[model samples]
Target chain A: MSVENLAISFGSNQVLKSVNLELHAGETLGVIGPNGAGKTVMLNIMTGILKPDGGRLVFLGRDILKEGVVERVRMGLGRTFQIPRSFRNMTAYENSLVGAVFGSGLTERAAGARARDILDMIGLSGKKLEPAGKLGLLDRKRLEIGVALATGPRALLLDEAAGGLTESEVAEILGIVRKVKESGVGVIWIEHVLQTMLHGTDRVMLLAEGRDVICGRPRDVMSSREVEEAYLGAGVGARTRRKRA
Target chain B: MGARTSGIRQIGGAPGPRGGWAARKPLVLAAAVVVLALLPLYASDYGISVGILIFLYMSLGQMWNLLAGYSGLVSLGQQAFVGIGGYTLAMVTQAYHMSIALSFFIAAGVSLAFALVISFPIFKMSGVYFTVGTWIVSEALLVFFRNWAFVKYDAGYNITVAYRISMPALYLGALAVGLGATALVYFILRSRMGLALMAIRDDESAAEARGVRLYRTKLACFLISSVYTGITGVVLYLNITYVKPGAAFGIDWTVCMVFIVVIGGLGTIEGPVIGAVIYVILRQYTYNFPGISMIMLGVAAVAIIMLAPEGIMGAVHGRFGFRLFSTERRPPPGTGPRQYPEDAADV
Candidate 1:
C-alpha cells in the first residue's frame, strides 16, 4: 500500500500537505511527531475515513479513494482507533466476531472460532465473554487490536496503541506488533512514545507541521539535524548523535 | 470449596444467568401464542375489540422499537406509513375492487415503496433533525390527503371491509399480524444484519470500519419497519371502520408507540409485548376518565424515563440478568475473574 501526494484541508487550516509514504509486506513503519502534526489524519485517509483533497491511495495496485470504509476494510485495510472504540455493549468475543464475520467474510461458526483465536492471541481469552465496557483500559486496547486483526487484513494501521500504557504494557504491545509483522502483514503505527517507536519499527518517519521532516532508519532519522530542529530537541538529538559517534 | 462447587453446578445446570432466562423464554412465548389463538373463541365482542387494539399497538410498538431503539433512527413520523396503509387499503378495496385480505398486502407494498422513496432524503438528517424530518413528512402527507380529490377530502374514507369480515376474523387477523411482525423482529435480531444494527447503534463510525454497510442496513430497517407499520394501520382503520387524515396521520399514533416502547423496554424483543399489555390495560381503565387519562399516561411515561432510562427490560436485565433474546456471549466454563488483581490496577 502507498500514498502519494496526499493533501487535506479543513476550511482555512490545511492538515496534511503532499504527504507521501509506501508500506511493503511484513514491514513496520513508525510515525512520530508532536501533536497536530497530522499523524492520525494520514492514517484516516489511508483507511478511507477521510477523503483527501488531492492524492492517490493505491492498495493492491488500485486507487481506493472512492471506496467506502467497509469496502476498504473488506479489501484488506484495517485500522484501530486511538481511543479504543470497542462495542461497549457487546462482549469482547462478539466484538471480534463482527470483524471476522463481516470484515473477513467468515461463516458464523468460523467467525466464532476466529474470534476465540484472536481473543486468545490478544491475551483476553479469560475475559472473552466479558462486556467490553467492563474491561480495563489495557484490555480495551488489546481488544481493539484483536478486532482489527480479526478482519484478515494484509495491512494494519494502529493509531497510538501504546499511548497510555505502562512500560511493561508497551513492551507487550511491541511483542504483539512484532508477531503481526512476522505474519507477513504490513503495519503503520503512529505513536508518541519515542522509545517504543524507535525500538519497535523497522523504519521511522518524522512529521512536523503537516510535512515529513525525515524518513529513514530509526537511528539515522533520530540523529538528523532536520528532525532535531523539527521534533526531537537539541539535547536528545546531541545525546543520540554522541551515542552513535 | 463450597462456593467453587456451587459455581460449577450453576454452569453445568444452566448456561449462565442469561442462559437460564433464555431456557424458559421459548416455552413462555409458545404458551402466550396458544392463549392468544384461543381468545376469539370465548372472548366477548367488546373483549375481542380490545384484544385487537392491543395487538395492533403491539405490532406498531415493535416496528418503532426496531427503527428508533435498535437502529437509532428516532423517527416521530411513523404515522406517515400508517396513514399510507389505511389510504391504500381504502383505495384498493373500493376503487380497485380487491379483496380486503389482498388489500393488506397491497397496502404494505405501497407503504414500503413510500418508505424507500422518502428514506433517501430523511436519513440524510441525523438525531433530532431526522425526527423533525419525519414529523414534517407525516404532516405533509396529512395535508395532501386532506386536499386530495378521490377519497372525499376532509370528509375521510369509510372502510367497507369492516362490513364484510366478522369481528372474530378481524381479531384473528390482527393477532396473526402482531405475531408475525414480532417473529420477524426476533429473527432479524438473531441474524447478521441484526448484529450490524446493534453495532451501528453502539457506534456508527466503528461499525462502518468493521465492514457494516451503514446506509444500506439502516435503509433496509426503515423499509421493513414501514411495511409492518403500514399493515398495522390497515388493521387499525378496518376495526374502526373509518379513516380520516386527522386520525390516520395523527401524531397520537407515534406518541402511543413511543410510550409503549419506552415503558416496556426500548430495544428488547419482549419489551413491546409486555409494554403493549400494560399500555392497553392502562388505556382501557383510563378510557372512562377522558380528561385525566392523558395526564396519567404522561405521568407514567415521565416516571419511566426518570427512573429507568433503559426501559423496564433493561433494568430487569441489569439487576436480575434476565435475557429472553440471548444476544450476550457465554464465557467458557473455567473463565472467571482475573488471577492477578494488581495487574488491572497497573494499567
Candidate 2:
C-alpha cells in the first residue's frame, strides 16, 4: 500500500500536508512523533475512515480513495483504534467474530473458530466470554489487536497499540507484533514508546507538524540530528533523553 | 491450566445440566401458542377484540424495537408505514376489487417499496435527526392523503361489503402476523445479521471498520420493520372497518409503540410481548375513565422508566439471570485452559 501527496485540512488548519509513505509486505514500519503530529489522521485516510483533500491511495495497484471503510477492509486493509473501541456490550469472542465474519467474509462456524484462535493468540482466551466493557485496559488493547487480526488483513495499521500499557503489557504486545511480522503481513505501527519502536521495528519514520522528518534504519533515525531537533521542537526531546539516560 | 479452569467457572461455566431459562423457552412458547389458538372458542366478543388489539400493538412494538432498540435507528415516524399499509389495503379491497386476504400482502409490498424510497433520504441523518426526519415524512403523508381527491377528500375510505372479512378471521390473522413477527425477530437476533446489528448499535464506526456495510444493513432493517408494521396497520384498520388519514397516520401510534417497547424492554424479544400485554390490559381498564386513561398511561410509563431504565425484561434478566431469548454464545464443550507461551512477554 502507498499514499502519495496526501493533503487534508479542517477549515484553514491543515492537518496533513503532502504526506507520502509506502508499506511493503513482511516489514514493520514504526511511526513515532510527538502528539498532534497527524499520525492518526494518516492512518484514518489509509483505512478509508476519512477522505483526503488531495492525494492518491493505492492498495494492490488500485486507487481506493473512493472506497468505503467496509470495502477497504474487505480488500485486505485492517486497523485498530488508539482507544480500543471494542463493542462494549459484546463479549471479546463476539467482537473478533464480527471482524472475521464481516471483514474476512468467513462463515459463522469458521468465524467462531477464528475468533477463538485470535483470542488465544492475544493471550485473552480466558476473557473471551467477558464483555469488552468490563475488561481492563491491557485486555482491551489486546482484543483490539485481535479484532484487527481476525480481518485477515494483508497489511495492518496499528494506531498507538501500546498507549497506556504497562511495561510488561508493552512487551507482550511487541512479541505479538513480531509474530505478526513473521507471518509476512505488513504493519505500520504508530507509537510513542521509543524503546518498542527502536527494538521492534525494521525501519522508523519521524513526523513533525504533519510532514515526514526522516525515514531510515531505527538506530540511524534515533541518532539523527533532524529527528532529535523535531522532537525537541515539540518539547519531547528532553523527556525522551532523560528516559534514555 | 488451574487458572483456566477457575476462570471458566468464574464466568458461569458451560450451560449447566438444567440449562438455564433459555432451554425451557420453546416448551413454554408452544403451550402459549396452543392456548392462544383455542381462545376464540371460549372467549367473549370483548375478549376477542382485546386479543386483536393486543396482537396489533405487540407486532408494532416488536418492529419498532427491532429498528430503534437493536439497530439504534430510533424512528418516531413508524406510523408512516402503518398509514401506508392501512390505506393501501383500503384502496385495493374497496376500489380495485382485490380480496381482503390478498390485500394484506399487497399492503405489505406497498409499504416496503415506500420505506425503501424514504429510507434513502432519512438515513442521511443520524441519531435524533433521523427521528425527526421520520416524523416529518409521516406528517407529509398524512397531509397528502387528506388532500388527495381520489380517496374522497378526508371523508376517508371504508372496507366495502364485497371485501369484508369475518371478525374471527381478522383476529386470527392479527395473531398469526404478531406471532410470525416475534419469531422472525427472535431468529434474526440469533443470526449473523443480528450480531452485525448489535455491533452497529454499540458503535457504528467500529462496526463499519469491521466490514459491516452500514447503509445497506440499516436500509434492510428499515424495510423489514416497515413491512411488519404495515401488515399490522392493515389488520388494525380492518378491525375498525374504516381508515381515515388523520387516525391512520396519527402520532399516537408511534407514542404507543415507544411506550410498549420502553416499558417492556428496549432490545429483548420478550419485552414487546410483555409490554403489549400489560399496555392493552391497562388501556382496557382505563379506557372508560375519560381523561384519566391518558394520564394513567403516562404515569405508568414514567414509573417504568424511573424505576427500571432497562425496561421490565431487562430488570428481570438482571436480577434473575434468566434469558428467554439470548444472543450470547456458550463455550465449546470440554474446552481446556488457555495457555500463553512461556516467552510471550519477553519481546
lDDT of each: 0.85, 0.86
> Lowest summed lDDT over 10 consecutive residues: which window, candidate 2 chain B?
B338-347
> What proportion of the real contacts between chains A and B does each prediction keep?
0.42, 0.46
Q: A128-197, model 1: which lDDT tens digit per residue?
A: 8888989998999999998898888888999999989999999988887887787778999999887777
Tens digit per residue, CA lDDT, model 2, B210-305: 999888888888899999899888888788778899999999999999999999999888899999999999999888898789999999999988
List the candidate 1 regions with Cα displacement exceeding 4 Å.
A223-228, A231-245, B1-21, B41-46, B329-347
Candidate 1 interface RMSD value: 7.7
* Residue-level lDDT tens digits of model 1 in B75-122: 999998888888888888877778877877888899888898888899
lDDT of 2 at B228: 88
Clashing pairs in 2: none
Clashes of each: 0, 0
How does model 2 fare in lDDT? 0.86
In terms of DockQ, the best-performing candidate is 2
